[model samples]
Target chain A: MAADQLAPERDTRAVEAGLDALDGGGELLPPRPGPWQVFVRSVLPPVVFMAALVGVWQLAYVAELKPSYALPGPADVWQTFWGTVQDGRAVEAVWVSVSRGGIGFAMSLVIGTLLGLAMWGSRWLRAAVGPIVSGLQSLPSVAWVPAAIIWFQLTDAAIYTVVLLGAVPSIANGLLTGFKQVPPLFDRVGRVLGLSTLGRVRYVLLPAALPGYVGGLRQGWAFAWRSLMAAELITYSPSLGLGLGQLLSIGRDLSSMSLVITSIALILLVGVAIELLLFAPLERRVLRTRGLTTDR
Target chain B: MTQVREQAPTRNTVAPPPAPAAVRVDGVTQVFERGRPPVLEGVDLTVAAGEFVCLLGASGCGKSTLLNLVAGLATPTAGRVEVSAERPALMFQEPALLPWLTARGNVELALKARGVARGARRTEAERLLELVNLGSHGAKRVHELSGGMRQRVALARALAQDSSVLLMDEPFAALDAITRDVLHEELTRVWTEQQLSVVFVTHNVREAVRLGQRVVLMSSRPGRIVREWQVDIPHPRAIESPAVGALASEITAELHREISRHGR
Candidate 1:
């Protein structure tokens, strides 16, 4: 026991020395990249891919692989794309489709969140709709277009119906999975704090499940975009305005490949732009603050 | 902080006022899993208001289970735990502070749960932090602080609950030797200043001897309270003092004998 007494005193002195020797531990944080480095990292890879795509097109053209109308050069596609943009036709078409997608997406967001939370309330509810919601996610958004036409018939309501059907399941499933993944430790802490059921959900469960819920929102947007395109192509009237989907359909009807390519490019650009400008930054901030995933 | 368990009947009464115990656990038995033997069997203990009692035990001695039963986090299979306080604030060996919240925010949560007014929560939380010597570290994230600093923040959060009793389950066990020593002093100071009754749990004999006014030892596997000592040493006792060392050795020998019985 005397020996044990001396040992802890000596251990205490060693621990004190160790404490004095320790640094501030700032080295654990990753260094911030400079502006020039960030710009290069973001811009260079995409530029290289675009260049490679153009090179492949040019090579096919010079070799006379199929007629000029069959595989038009990148320059021809750009010309038609530039023409549409300069005349404000592309911009108008974008506004029409994006507004439709945006409205549908907002509705789905509310509906999906409510449905997901309802699923969390009981195992029976989860067992009933859980598999069905997941199954809906795998079904193509375009597959709903015919039924939507029969139900709403060439109206803006029909397009919205298809868009909602496409996006709602993804958002709902994301929230369901997110809630399921909340750590049991948080439940113990919640009970200790004497939080009410609503308080526990608000303060603990919701924020803890945010990463997965946001991931679902991102997927929902993709589905909404695709559904909007499918509905627009199939059910267009002059009253509905010429959306990008209609423009692509018109190009096919008129046998102009350049117009078709231009529409495809605009659709791809919108999807990429939304992901880059909105969801990526939101996900990064959430993951970083929670210490879930580091920026590096 | 003394609670009058009952008021006079508004007339002259001859009965003496009962000195209410902070906590009373009578024949507490805990059976965690069905069809398995109970983890704790027929354990009884009482902690008086403002008294510091250390529960010393071997590894599987169900000491934490006893603390949980007192904290109202778990129920005893047979027997009752009576506490005069509204609810006992519990501190774990790990800091257990929410990582998403700032240090002050963590304390504010306890105050919020206790139904303190929104306008008063911030000031109350800040005062608690100041009591724990973490006034300036309120805005810092959990990971930003050192282990000892985090534990101090946790202590502040526990105090924000405004409970008359505090239950600590090896609260300083994970800290370094020097840090643990500093925390023991800090805890003793805070405990006295606030007049909080505490049931501190630990396996270290020296820690039990140093901090407790009374020490209770338990045996393992369906843990039972085997022995107890009322330590009469005065406050501000040092761990390295000869008196603490002597009592710790005596208790250590008893603990060894208790453990040796399991080998057979």
Candidate 2:
């Protein structure tokens, strides 16, 4: 009876000692950075970079290194910007291009995501359609302008067709890469946990492939934007209103250097805005949550 | 021979009442290539319900392959493997937790795959975390936890499956010595409390003796069970104990011999 009692005490002491030894390595918790610190760390560097870039442009203009018409001064660009806004055409052009790109890009996203899923899910489908998608990706979106115009007769549908051709392959390929890269261990774990095929796709497969999928979406959007601009420039219809591409064409036809510069700047600004304001945040959130990218 | 007979009654009494062994492997042979020799040849073993069995072998001994076969991730080229109930849960050397999920979400995923209701998942997940003494770490993301904490969370996730059989492939090999010892104790307590049948594969003989009731030693190159030792030592066996050290040394010597044969 005494031996039994002593054995329990000894066991408890050993467990306590083991636990203490492990805990002696100190806190296993990660230190959380303050919100202000994180915000400043993330936001300040980009702002500083932009400021430096603008300053350099202004300095180059002041130095008079190039003629105003060839390389317009910073002031010239700003004045043109204000003039376009005053005429209300700048806002109008932005609205037209943004609306068309939004609708066309949405269509491309759906088609691409579906195609990607098909490519990943079925070997036969991939064998039949995979190379065709790769070939499409290699052909520049501008190359499709003539074909799109001929097929849709210079209508909005034709512009959308070009955008779809440009974006679909990118999205599909991105998802395919993502799906293929999911670790076999995760699949095994999923199977042992009783995950059905659909369940595995929904949870493990999709989440694991998200980074690659996001990368594809980013590439797809770039293609969609470029394709839309190229199609708009070529297929000029009165019903299409006046997009940024049309403004550039009109500027070229009328020989208005200021209008040309303003239109080009606006196009560049919209692309940067979409990337920085929208997709950048989305990608950062996914990466940060997945612990793939660290803010510090 | 007399000692084996003397211990038979105690073994029977200790084993939980079950129709057959929790896992049964009969003449199982795994071949790497059609023309090559088999990795595991004509191996037969049975694990009783609630019993802890350790498979100790050196590198290239195909111990992990055997575990994988039992887990149903790989098939034996010859013979059969049978599990009494559901598929066994598997734990790897690395925690292998989904990087995107919190500690609780990782466990919840297991329950979710088993079709547990969403309303009950949170509670059940918390319960599992509590069982692993990490009840407060439900919201901690995978990257936020230390290596030891991550493995504990993985252990919780494995247990959440609630399967009769658990297959562990050196789950603590990546951890530091101190953490591994602590986890060994934690694993022992949980295994006894839950009454699980475990087929733990490890290269460390001390680890095998520390946790298992039966340590099965396998020879390399067409891995086969060369010997089996029944550890009569009680729970929380000291690593430095005379019996534990003696068995460990014996197993190590056997492993060295098996490795040298390959070199020759």
Candidate 3:
């Protein structure tokens, strides 16, 4: 009886030791970075970089590198930025641009996903259209504005057309690249599990291709925003309201360099804000959850 | 090594009788490329229900290819491979668990594929996780688990397939010794409890002998079954036990002889 009892204890110990060894060596559970640590690492450096950039801009202004009328100092631009905001023009302009960009990006996402799946499904289609899609990515968003204006008559439809043309190819290519990169082992495993082709695409292929898909989404957003701005600047209608691009156009027409600089600053700020707020965090989470991110 | 002539080929020509087969591979040939030689040629084997069979051979023996054939991932160029169940669940050398999924989610996927309802999947997945001694770590991601734990989760996922046959391709080869030993014990207990017919592929002689009721040895180039040894050791066999050691050495000697045939 005692020997049997002792044997069970010994087996438990052996199992415990084995489990401990399993938990050893390549234990990649690095301590999660604290919020304060994240703030220092991610937020501080960019703030410092921006500060240095402003200092350089101020230095160039102080040195009188250009006439004040032609090139505004940081203070003049800052003053104009505040005036624009105080008059509520900045908020309206931001809302107009952001809403338009959001709608255009959503449309691009749907269309691109369909196109990508089609390309991935057939070698013939991929060969025929894959290069064309990639080529569209190299064609600047600004380049689509003239054709969009001709196609849709300088309305919001024209702006959306430009955004779609600029963004869809990028999103499609992202999905294609992601699909291509999915490990063959996953497909084998999926097959063993008896998942259907559609099921495999939904559960295995899409999740596996997320990093590239998200990368495409980020690029697509950038394209949509750029194309919207280009369209707004070139093809203005009273019904479109005061978009950021319209603000920039107005500043140029007024010949107030400070206003132009202020609008540019606001545009830059919005771009950075969207990336930091939406895409960067999304990409980081995707990578982190997959354990693809290392401390280095 | 003892030259026991009668016990050498323990298959049709020597062993008393064959049991009800859970898996049957008859004259199966696998050709990867048309111009090159076949990976496996004229291989014949049968695994009985509730029996643990180990396929042992040197590297490039097409042992993995044979498992893939049985898994239905690869179709043989000639002959037939049959499993008693719908399909056998395969465990690769690597865990091959979806990295994005938690341990429970990975197991749940198999159950889901098996058409388990959403409401019952959680409980079923939990039960499978408990079977592999990973009940507490079910929420952990694949990368969070240790290598051994990952394999255990994989075993649980395989279990979730609810298939009678389980094909493991050197599942514990990547693990440390202590972990491998523990896994061996766990596997034996689970195999007995679940009454599964397992075809475990490994290069380790001791692992084959320790775990298998029958060890099938294969030769390298154009892999073919060369010999078989029937191990009559009782259940709950320890890796370090004398019986296991003796059988392992015998099989190792046979394996080395098979390897030597290729060296020329």
Candidate 4:
């Protein structure tokens, strides 16, 4: 139809300015808490919870509910914990276990990502190996400790074997889940944009799958830590050296309740510290970039 | 308005089409699978260069299927679908912006796909964003944008492909009425400015009237073009204008007749 060309009722730039103002949130991003505020919010709650736990332990001791050998006083456990720290045994044990976990998890990450890509690329491989991978995740890594000890002779190899078994399945399955979550629309968008097959995977498919993949990595780390603890506790040869789990095992043999309690606490601390320092931040960043985080 | 199958229904039907054809679909029968009725059977539609055509239909009419054909996202089982230039840009019912990218980043990806050098992409992306009246909001992530803004960005992204034709599948169908109305004006302005051929698919009668130069009605159950109407009303046409309403009701009556057939 012969109509005069678009005559803007108002100046378009002015209109755009108004529209842009309204398009953004009235408050935009909520102000993040300052470092002090963050400390209070996060650190305070856990500190209070731990204090209450210690208070309960003190009450149990005051009541003399169990023999002193069976249930050590909270103060006695604390003193053992500090003694382990001062003697440098704590640092050495932490270093040995953490290094093993880190190396084992890295190998699993590479192998698991390749396996996932292969599974994605070929439907036959997916059909053949998909169910087994998922089943492996439910199978506790500790179950393999005896087998690994027999195969690798109760050394670092055995500990690493257990860690890899525990983590690889979760990492592989995480990649698959991420791939599945990518919408078919993305491929079509890729096609319409004239992206090649590799380009499609690199740009659209990979980014879409990232949130799920990070979730898998988080779960994998948890499994690796648990499995490493199980392996060290069970298959401690002289060659395997001292680790937090070996301390826990030694404490059990010696019948020192405070040492056993201290070892368990250190193990728990390592697990939590890794999560807080590494995986939590990584997962948060991935989800935040995709706007998948619910906290706006 | 005429229903002649022999020739394209242009404003001056007596004269041969003035512009070169942008798209030509000849007797395309798209049967997705064997042993099933075809979704689009013998559907022939032509879009001339720089023309704005709206395809009106009921659900299951293969409207989207046909657009997919023109987009080269699909192949016709029995006939030919041709586009004169490079692959046409396509817009979805949803904005389909990648959530991980900023609005400008999405457009830049399209530019990169077109083989625009890495050096020129940033400025080119900004220019396209400005075209859609979103120059200031290029850095905003997809989720940060509102529904209307997302679609506008989508339009900009489509333009980044630099395609001569644009195939839109109900691009405004998901918007609220007020937002939809505003988008009609924006689309009209963009269409006239770009002088690009658009194959717009929609079921909204007034939307077809307010935007398209020729509104082509289609039938379901093996989709076919049933009728065509040439809107004489001039551009900058208001959605609520009386002329748009008058023609819209006429098309609505025909659409109602088509829908009532499904009841049986």
Report the number of the highest-DockQ candidate: 4
TM-score of each: 0.87, 0.88, 0.91, 0.95
In order, the interface RMSDs are 6.0, 5.0, 5.0, 3.7
lDDT of 4 by residue, B80-198 (tens): 98998688999999999998999999999999999999999999999999898888889988878878889999999999999989999999998877667677877888899998899
Which stretch of 10 consecutive residues in model 4 chain B shows the poorest summed lDDT? B1-10
The clash tally of candidate 2 reads: 0
lDDT (10s digit) by residue, model 3, range A137-238? 999878878887788887898899989989999999999888988999998889999999888888898999999999999999999889888888888778
The CAPRI quality class of candidate 4 comes to: acceptable
Residue-wise C-alpha lDDT for candidate 1, range A1-296, written one tens digit per residue:
22233323233334533442462131256778888888799788889998998999999988889899988988888899999999998998888888888999999999999989898888899999999998999999789888888988889989989899899999999998888888876777777778898899888889879989999999999899999999899987887788889988888888999999999989888888998999889888777766676584
Query: How far does residue B212 in candidate 2 sit from its true spot (Å)?
Result: 0.8
> lDDT (0-100) at residue A100 of candidate 4?
87
What tens digits encode model 3's per-residue C-alpha lDDT throughout B157-183?
A: 999999999999999999889788888
Clashing pairs in 4: none
Which structure is stronger by DockQ: 3 or 4? 4
Docking class of 3: acceptable
Off by over 4 Å in 4: A1-20, A26-30, A35-37, B1-16
- Model 4's TM-score against the true structure: 0.95
Which prediction has the highest TM-score against the true structure? 4
Candidate 1 overall Cα lDDT vs. reference? 0.84
Per-residue lDDT, model 1, residue B140, is 75
Q: Write the per-residue lDDT of candidate 2 for residues B88-128, one digit (tens) a residue.
A: 98899888899889999999999998778999999999999
